[model samples]
Target: MDRKTKIALGGGCHWCTEAVFQSLKGVNKVEQGYVASHGINSNFSEAVIVHFQPEKISLKTLIEVHLLTHKSTSNHSMRIKYRSAIYTFSEVQQKEALSLLDEFKSKSDSNIITQVYPFSAFEPSRNEIQNYYRQNPEKPFCKQFINPKLQLLLQHFSNYVNEDNIKHTDQK
Candidate 1:
């Protein structure tokens, strides 16, 4: 069996981010919660720790999907609550994330503000809200905010997306 790896991501609503990662092929689990790094990012922010098999999904692909799914370029007012960050478990992971961000920055007109920080801690959300999207697919927030991100996954990362996890708009 392949060893599972983890990467913590935060940029938008935890519900939306959780749903997006949950729909991916290699993702074994997504721990929806608040995460905190060191120094300036000491305060917990909305995020999810994605557990996956690297052999099935590359870190670069995961980062790419994450960037595309959220407002990676925006330093919005709620940024304190929803930090744009990639929390890595190792120095290698941090370097790769930084390299990927730099590469993306060169191609896009807007700066990729997503920072790579060392993973420090994670506080899981309440059990009631753990799997928010899957549990409440018909919720207005799921339909309005999350569905679009799922659709984007289907459109651009179809090979990496788990189609079974996608609740089609017609079915909703």
Candidate 2:
């Protein structure tokens, strides 16, 4: 678990997910990209690839972070382009992911549609796309959508994120 485990996750739009993961304590990096494996079947889907430290965090925690985001803080871009997913790098991770999803559904108020499968090649998104929300926090999309999600993070999951990255704007 010393090495970072790569988890390919798509939670609607990559911009905000990148912003969100960048604020995490154990997430080494959140890569914006097109999952070539997913794109092979469709003409319109985009994705986010997350590389995180499993020693500092767990895949279950990663999934929880994504589920919380997609459930309560998403908009049309994610709805149309992104679907909740975990692209696994190993068979053990695959089993754990499904088990967690099943357990989560049983305890939750609503059903989840998170897709889990094996990993494949990905095309990295360009430099400009990385941390787009932070770069343009005042943009209409960031102000209205990503801001609210950040607010939710500040209000509720304050302990889970990298508090050093939390800004003055996060003050409530």
Candidate 3:
């Protein structure tokens, strides 16, 4: 069996991030959750823990998709809780994320404010919140916010998308 690896990401809302990663082919699972907490304070930024097949999808690709899908350059004033972040589980993951950040920064003039931090803990979101886009596609928020992001994923990362998600998206 292929070895799987995991990474935690915080990009705006967990619902949107979870939906995007779930569509990818090599992603074994995506759990919406809160990460890097501190007891009752629970720095608990909305995040997703992605379990994936390294042979099928490189961590670099996942990070790239993440940066592209979210507004990494925007100030967090509109939604302080939704700051962009990449929480690494190991030194290797942190290095890869930082390398990607440099690469992305070199490519674009916009400041990439996506924070990189060591992974502390993850508290899964309520069941109702998991698989949100799949469960509530018709909701105005999903249609207005998520659908476009999904379309962008399909357009730019067509090879990474799951065939089932493509068919489901097509039927809509």
Candidate 4:
């Protein structure tokens, strides 16, 4: 069996992030939840633990997709609640994520504010609210907030997308 790795990501609403990761090909599970890093980031923030097989999808690709799907550059008022961060489980992942972010920054006109932090703790979202998008795809929140992210995924990273997990009608 292939070894699976997990990474926590936070940028936008957890619902949106969860759905976006769920639509990916190599992602085995997306745990929508709250995550806290060390130091100043001790407070829990909306995030998702994406469990995936690196052999099937590279971390570089996952990080790239994450950067594009959310407001990685924007330092908005709700940043406290929605931190722009990548919570890495290991030293290697941390270094790789930082390098990827730096490389991404070099190519962009705007500064990338996505922080790379060591994973500290995670509290899974309440059962009723977990997998919000898949259960409530027709709801306004899913349609308005999540559908676009999935569309962007299909547009730019279709090769890594699991088409079966996505409802094409939601893209309309």
Give candidates' CA RMSD values in order: 1.4, 3.0, 2.5, 1.1
lDDT of 4 at 93: 91
Ranking by lDDT: 4, 1, 3, 2
- What is the C-alpha lDDT profile of model 3 across 1-172, one tens digit per residue? 7999999888778888998899999999998978873343247788899999999998889988999898988876844477588888988889988888788878988998887788888889988788898888788887777877788888899899885763445333
Top TM-score model: 4
Which model is ahead, 1 or 3, in terms of lDDT? 1
Q: Rate the local accuracy (lDDT) of all candidates.
A: 0.92, 0.70, 0.82, 0.92
Q: List where candidate 2 sits over 4 angstroms from the true fold.
A: 38-44, 71-80, 168-172
Q: Give per-residue lDDT, candidate 4, residue 112.
A: 84
lDDT of 2 by residue, 32-111 (tens): 87663445533234567778888887788778777877652334445446756667778888898889878777777866
Model 3 — which ten-residue stretch has the worst lDDT? 163-172
Worst 10 residues of 1 by lDDT: 163-172
What's the residue-level lDDT of 56 in candidate 4? 97
Off by over 4 Å in 4: none
Q: TM-score, each model?
A: 0.96, 0.83, 0.90, 0.97
After superposition, the stretches of candidate 3 with alpha carbons farther than 4 Å from their true spots are: 37-42, 166-172
Model 2 score (lDDT): 0.70
Model 4: lDDT to the true structure:
0.92
1 or 4, greater by lDDT: 4
